[model samples]
Every structure is written in C-alpha cells, then in structure tokens.
Target: MFELTRYDGRRRVRGSIALSVGLSALAAMVIWVYPSFEAEVDLDQLLAAYPDPILQVMGVQTMTSLGGFLSFELYTFGWVIMLGLYLAYSTAGTIADDVDRGRMDVLLSMPLSRRRLVAERFAAMAVPIVGANLLPPVVVFIGARLIDHPLAATDVLAVHLLSIPYLFACAGIGLLASVVFDRAAIAQRVALGVTFALFLSESLLTGTDAETVGSIAPMRYYDPNAVLLEGHYDLVGAGMLVAMTLAFLVASQLWFGRTDIH
Candidate 1:
C-alpha cells in the first residue's frame, strides 16, 4: 500500500513543489503590498459603497485591514479558485489516465485488489494538495510580520489546517469523476467544470433566501475569509467537509471495484 502511494505521489512531485512555491510567493506579495494599499485606498469607504451581496460573493466583510485584504484576495479568490482547480485537475487523471493508457491491467496483475488500488491512488492525491496548502501560511505570516500587520498565528494556522479537508473533498470529487469517465482529459474537464460551477453557485447563493442551496457546495463549508479575518473556525463545517471527502472516496472505491476498468 505504501509503495503504491509513493509511486503515485512521486508523479506529482514537480507539480506539488511548483504549486507550493507559486502560492507562497503570491501570499508574500499580497502581504508585502499591504502598506501601500492601506495608505492609498479608503478601504472601509470603498467596501461600504458595495452592496452586501457583492461583499458576500467576494467573501470579504472588510478590506481595511491586512487580515481582511488577505482573506479577500489571497484566501477567497486565489487559494479557493487556484488551489481548488489544481487539485481537481490533478486528481481527475489519477485513475482515468491509468485505465485509459491500459496501465490498469499491469497494475492490477500485481496481486492488488481494485479496492486497495483505487483507495491508494486516491489517498496519494493528498500529498501534493497538503504540501501546496502548507507553504502559503508560513509566507503569509512572515510577510505580515515584516509589514507590521501581523495576523494572529492561531487564525492563520486554523485557516490552512482546515483547508486540507475541504481540498481533500474536492479531490475526491475529481477522483470519482476519473473513475466514471474513460478518458483522463475528459475526466479532468468534467471535474474542473463541476468544481467551478459549485464555487459560483455558492458565491451567488450567499446572503440570499436561497442560501441554503449553497450548502451543497463544499465552498460553503470552507471559508478562509471567516477563519482568517473574523477568527471564526467552524468545527461543524469542517467535520461536514471531512464526511463529504470520506463519502466520495468510499463511493469511488466501490464504483471502481465493481466496474470494468478497461
């Protein structure tokens, strides 16, 4: 099991490193420029001019502070869209690519059952996602301190730590799509489309009478803005994300186990 996980994880090494570096750099840049923005823009005035729905959609209650700015720009948009898409895109090919390239036969002939094979492959997807999620907080913390706008360390830590489960859920969705679709590229497209659609749905539904509809989307549970800016860590929400992740993984394993790999 460990060997299978290592082999699958090795394929994502370059991508994982690149994503970590990219997001960490972005976090540093966002934090580094806080002073300049604070000096120029009247954030409270500007944010107040916007409607509540607009603010809700943007996942920002305020932009006058470093934490708020980071929540809006880096956490809500950058991490949610960029990291979420990357996870979905990467995981979408984990199973589908092997099956499409006829590599599943050789893999299965190694005395591994389909359940273990799919579970191991799905589990390995966490390596890169978790790696990419970790570096940004360190960079953000350092940059914030340098800029004299240091965020609460616990809040920063909470946001990143809680993000893993949400991202894992997203990857599981993509993994399930990979198993359902025959072509890796097609699976990737499907995963990307669904992930983006859910994001949009959640954003649009927020603050509306139909906000309950957004509950179905994972983004509703994973609010970095709330965690970092308001210091509100939703334990129940995090647990729900974990449940969703497990459900998707189990479904993928069961489906892959019963279906024809070819």
Candidate 2:
C-alpha cells in the first residue's frame, strides 16, 4: 500500500517540496525578520508617540521589542493566516491530485488496502511540512546570533513545537477532504476556505468578545505571545492540538477505509 501510493505521490512530491521551501523563506522574511526590524525601530514607542485611537487603527502600539512581535499583532495574524493558506495549498490536493489524474485506481489495484495507501501518502506530505515549520527558526537563530541577542533554544523550538501539530491537523483536514470530495479542485477549495475561516475567527477572537467563536479555531489556543515571548506554554492547548491531530488522522483513515475509490 505504502509503495503503491507513494509511487503516485512521488510524482507530485517534488513540486510540493519546492513550495515548502518557498513558504519557509517567505515565512522567515515576513513573519520573523519583518517583526525583528520593526521591533528594533521601537515600534511600540512610535505607537505610543501617537494617540490611542490612531494606534488602535494602525495597530502598532502592542509591539515594544523583538519580543513584542509575538503578540496578536497584524503581522503575527498575517503569519498564521498565510501559513494556514500554505497548509491548505500543500496538503489539500495531495491525495485527490492522484485520483483526479486517474491514478487512484492504478495504485489501488495492487495488493494494498486503501487505508494503508492514504496513510503513507499522508506521511509523505509531512516531509515538506517539517521543513516549512523548522526553517523559520533556523533563520531566526542565525539572526539572533548575528545580533548577540537571546535566542533561547528551547523557546525557538517551542514555537515550532507549538506549530507543527496545527499543520498536521490541517493536513488531516485536507486528507479528509480528499476522501470525501472527488474533484481535486473542490477538495482544495474546501480545505483552504475552511482553514482561512478558522484563522479569521481566531484573529477576531483575540481582540473582540468572541471567545465562543474561538473555541472553533484551533489557532486561538496557541497564544503565540505567551508561548513565543513569555516562554510559557499552555500544555492543555498543546495537548488539545495533539488530540485534534490524532482525531483528524483517525477520521481520515476511517473515511478512506469506507470510501469507494472507483
């Protein structure tokens, strides 16, 4: 099952790997360094230098230093939203792509269970995800080194540690879509739209009285400010993320198991 599925997966894997690299680079620049430089300029002071209403609209006062970047600021929200988009883009069509290209039957005809086949294909998708999640910290590490700043290895790792489960959850969501939606384009659309909606719900919940909506968006639980800056992790939130990933993975397996690939 693994061999057959991946034989088809290997077809699309290279391009996705390239995309992961691109995502990592873009994330490092937009999410990591943009805030780093914005911090150096004392964006907080500048915001404070302005009036409350103005800063409220511009959304700069929340940041005081490189550390302040972790707050639910625009860039942080942007990063979460953008990464979700990438996750959807990368994982959504992975399985359905093969099927739409008329290859699901070719692979399933071999001595393999559809469940086992989808599982391996799902694992194959993670290689690029790991690369995407890990790459930013490496750049941040190098930047921290160059500036003689503190880069608590644990904290740096904590950010990625906090992030990867969400990635898998998204991947699982995509795979679930793959099994349910016959058209690759439709599957990709469902995953990307749903993930982005989650991102927006979480962001809005960060400021407004929308905690209820937040319960629906997993990213709301991450609290990058506390984890990335305060160096405190919400074990419960992280645990839930893990649980969600497992749930989605199992759901994917079950859905695929019952699916008629023909």
Candidate 3:
C-alpha cells in the first residue's frame, strides 16, 4: 500500500512542488499589495457598488481588513479554481493511465487487491493536494505579519486545515472518473467539467432560493473565505465534506473492484 502511494506520489512530486512554491509566492505578493489597497480605496464603498452576484462570485464581502482581502484575492479564487482544477487533472489519470498502458494487469497479478489499489491511489492523490494546501497559509501569514496586517494564527491555520477535505473530495471525484473511463483524456475532461460545474453552481446559486441545488455541490460546504475572513469555522460543513469524500472513495473502490480491466 505504501509502495503504491509512493509510486503515484513520485510521478507527481515535481509538479506538486512547483505549484506549492508558485502559490506561496503568489500569496506573499497578494499580501504585499494589500497595504496599497488600504491606502488608496474606500473598500466598503467600492465593494458595495458591485452587484451581489459579482461580490458572491468574487468572495469579497467586507474589504476593510487584510483577512477579507486575502480570502478574496488568494484563497477564494486561486485555491478554489486553480488548485481544484489541477487536482482534478492530476488524479484523472491515476487509474486510467495504468489500465490504458496495460500496467494494471501486471499490478493486479501481484498480491494487491483492487479495493486496496484504488484506496492507495486515492491516498497518493492526497499527498500533492495536502502539500499544495499547506504551503500558502504560511506564506500568507508571514506576509501579513511583514506588512503589519497581522492575521490571527488560528484563522490562518483554519483556512488551510479545513481545505484538505474539500481537495480530497475533489480528488475523489477525479479518481472515480479515472476508474470509470479507460482513457485518461476522457477521464480528465469529465473530472474537470464536473468539478468546475459544481463550483459554478455553488457560486451562483448560493444565498438564493436555488441554494438547495447548490448544496449538492461539494464546494458548497468548503468556504475558506468564511473561515479566514470571518473566523467562522463551520464544523458541520467540514463534516459534510468529509462524509462526501468518504462516499466518493467508497464508490470508487466498489466500482473499481467490479471493473473489467483487460
């Protein structure tokens, strides 16, 4: 199991490291620029001028503080869209690539069970996502402190810590797609489409009559903006994310267990 996890981890390690470094730099840069915004604009007035839908999509409620700014500029858009899509793309090929290349037969011929194989591969997918999620908060925290904005350490920690299950749920969707489709490209497309669509639905339908529809999206329960900016950690929301992730993983295991990989 550990070997299977390491094998997948090694394949994606370089790319994951690059992404983490890039996000950290970006977070620092974003925090660095916060002072200028504070000096220039009447943020509350500026934010109020935007339509509610735009504000909701942008994830900026109050622009009076550093936490709100970072939540809006860095975590909400960058992590939700960029990191989420990257995970989908990375995991979408995990199972399909092996099957497509005829490596699944050789692996299955060994002592590995199909259920264990899928679980280990999913665990491997978590490595990059967890690493990517962990690095940005440190950069953001240090940058905030350097700029004298001084976000609470607990808020900084909560933002990244709570995001893990969300990323896992996103990866689980891709893993399920990878096993269902024999072609990696097709799996990737499906995963990307589903993930983005869910995000868009959550973004658009939230706080409206159609919120029930949005509730079905995994992204609905994972709001780093709430955690980082408002200091509101939704334990129930985090629990829901965990439940959804487990559901996806179980479905993946069962599906892969019954799959006919030639």
Report the alpha-carbon TM-score of model 3 versus the true structure. Answer: 0.94
Q: What TM-score, over all chains together, does every model reach?
A: 0.94, 0.79, 0.94
Between which residue pairs do clashes occur in model 2?
none
Q: Which regions in candidate 2 have their CA more than 4 angstroms from the true location?
A: 4-42, 45-61, 70-79, 206-210
Instruction: Mark the 10 consecutive residues where model 3 has the least summed lDDT.
Output: 56-65
lDDT of 1 by residue, 1-262 (tens): 4678989889878888888999898888888788998998888888888997778677777788888898888988777777788788889999999989999889889988888888888889878878887688888888888888888999999989988888998898799999999799999999999998989899998778998988878888888878876799999999999999989888988888888866
Full-model lDDT, candidate 3:
0.85
What value of lDDT does candidate 1 attain over all alpha carbons? Answer: 0.86
Task: Estimate every model's Cα lDDT from 0 to 1.
Answer: 0.86, 0.66, 0.85
| Ranking 1 against 3 by lDDT, winner | 1
- The all-Cα superposition gives candidate 1 an RMSD in Å to the true structure of 1.6
Q: RMSD to native for every prediction? A: 1.6, 4.1, 1.5
The runs of at least 3 residues in candidate 3 whose Cα sits more than 4 Å from the true structure, single-residue gaps closed, are: none
lDDT per residue, candidate 3, 6-66, as tens digits?
A: 8878877887788889999989888888899899999988888899888877667776888
lDDT of 2: 0.66
Sliding window of 10 residues with minimal summed lDDT for model 2: 52-61
lDDT string for model 2 (116-203, tens) is 7777877776665665655566665565556555567777677766777777776777777777787799999999888877766665
Q: Whose lDDT is higher: candidate 1's or candidate 2's?
A: 1
